[model samples]
Target: MKLDESALAATTNDLTREVDARGVADLIEFRMDQADDPLEQLAAYDGELPIIATNRARWFGGKASDTGRLDDLFSASRYDAVEFVDIELETVRAKEWLAHEFRENDVQLIISHHDFEETPDRDVLDAIIEQCAEFGDVAKVAVFPQNQGDTLTLLEAVNDATNRGIDVAGISMGEIGSHTRVIGHLYGSKLGYAPLLADDNDYAPGQIPLEKLASLIELTKNERVDGQVIDTIRSEVSVPKELTLSD
Candidate 1:
């Protein structure tokens, strides 16, 4: 299904974690760069959760080598379990060939931006998100926030983008801005990602533990509303299991 509403995703490199993530996260992000036998795992996947395939490049803060990385992701994106694919906005915009290929595979896209240094100002954030929205089905921006103000700026950008009807996910990394991952969904951030495995926090800093995030989403499930920011609410998030490929 389309990422048309608020949802949480468990970010992991292990396919086995998918079953455990059910009833909590709406999606499982399979990190091909980190997984051993990634394609072999994909071919064997019989789990319940739908997958969001990601083979992050080294330039994008991932361990994957530059050579054949896109080719690997290309192969991953076509798997039966994968419904969404996360590609860097830079990569897609540079050639945009992958974006077109993903479309032909009948998979949705999440064009993401990452700022490992610090969060950009509102205008730059908006511009990046807007450009991503133009290139794919969802626009995702993940940045390291130096302080509370930086987190606030990211939130405002998420709110503005959501009100403008863009499917987006806003993540403020590190301990300082970790709260945004949970509260972002309340502001119409279409996706919230949490640690899927025990050591997964190294890849995604300051992430809420998967189970805790699930509880938080469950507690606030009734508070989910539509088309508003902050004080408003969104409807209940989709049941994660319901989106499984087996269905």
Candidate 2:
């Protein structure tokens, strides 16, 4: 599935409420690691929303702890509904075998890394983006921002990566850095993630509801109708695959 010119939101639950409410073309994230029976859930999911599977590891603030986590991820990619799979940069760098396996499966990979502590310096962030770009279809980085400067740093990284023709999703976590979600898209971020349910059960810090984010992005794009803002927003919302699954 292609990820271009459309808003793809996230759904934590196995339901399709978020996708329906926001009128988004895709669901950018489904935290498989958090599910009791991830494979079963995937198998039973007949909802009209394409999924981007993510079984993040504990090192990356995810609940997956089994030694065979990577193996499970590789298997999940085989599911026809899974258009994109998020693999941590650490795993991609350490496990060359898994990297090749993803390539062999013809599954799109999103090499991601999260820093819950603090955002890195400009050069450091750039280097990380470069490394992830080498291996995955999209290079994603989520960093915690201590202050406004840290948020700006993330914007710079997102802009720089997109300027260099790299597909990137950059965000700053935490209360102080929440606005990065909207601004990131303006700065050329290819994707944004919002909760399926806008309640307190969201997986990420400072995440807004899918509908709100879609509205905000639309408003921002409308305000800046010139340049590639409209195209970028459109790209962020398009779904590469059909949402329905046949039995």
Candidate 3:
């Protein structure tokens, strides 16, 4: 429920199979916008894992439309299993009033921003994260990077925000920036999202399979303790950030 540093969540449209990933996932991120009958599925959900309800909008790389999207998220907050609710940073900016409702309900908010094209500059990224911090419990940024350099820009923003005491989740989407997803955790990112099954279409580019990602995170952390230089491990190992537990 409370997203702490290094917490990994599985993102899925199908909640029925969520129990299949119980041991691996800290929580299940229900992609409400992608589901055919989201509310119905929620009513039937009795999975062991806690839920982070997200009803993403079409304008922000999801299928859900504007109509009743916010209403649905509000409804989801009432679910006993749901501990976190994700709202697009753009949506929050447009509908400032929703912040009051979330606060009144005492629902934890994950304010997210996505850049499908390219990771923004450090200044822009910092500003976006600052704005997100003001509106929600956690500031989450997902960016598409053209090259490794772009990932650094994202990491820089993450570092800056975290250093300033902001709760943040930074993800560099796509192949070029995949490493940032794993590496960002070292910089104090509070959350990482992955898919429950391998071979499933990734919600974002460069997402590492859940099983591999978890192993890599462990390997790297142990390596850090074993006196292996993290710089070397990072350069040689192609670790990704987003999770997917594939068979």
lDDT string for model 1 (56-161, tens) is 9889888789898888888888887899988999999898777898788888899999999999989999999999999999999999999899999999999999
| Candidate with the greatest lDDT versus the true structure | 1
> Could you give me the TM-score of model 2 versus the true structure?
0.85
Clashing pairs in 3: 181-241, 194-243, 198-246, 209-244, 210-244, 210-245
For each candidate, the alpha-carbon lDDT, in order, equals 0.87, 0.80, 0.86
Show where candidate 2 strays beyond 4 Å. Answer: 15-22, 198-200, 224-247
Give the candidate order by descending TM-score: 3, 1, 2
Which residues of candidate 3, in runs, are more than 4 Å off? 224-247
Q: Write the per-residue lDDT of candidate 2 for residues 17-88, one digit (tens) a residue.
A: 434543553664778777777787777667666678898888888888968787777777887777788998
Where's the lowest-lDDT run of ten residues in candidate 3? 219-228
| Residue range 28-113, candidate 3, lDDT tens digits | 88999888799999999988998899998888888888899989989888888888889989989989998888767767889999
| lDDT computed for candidate 3 | 0.86
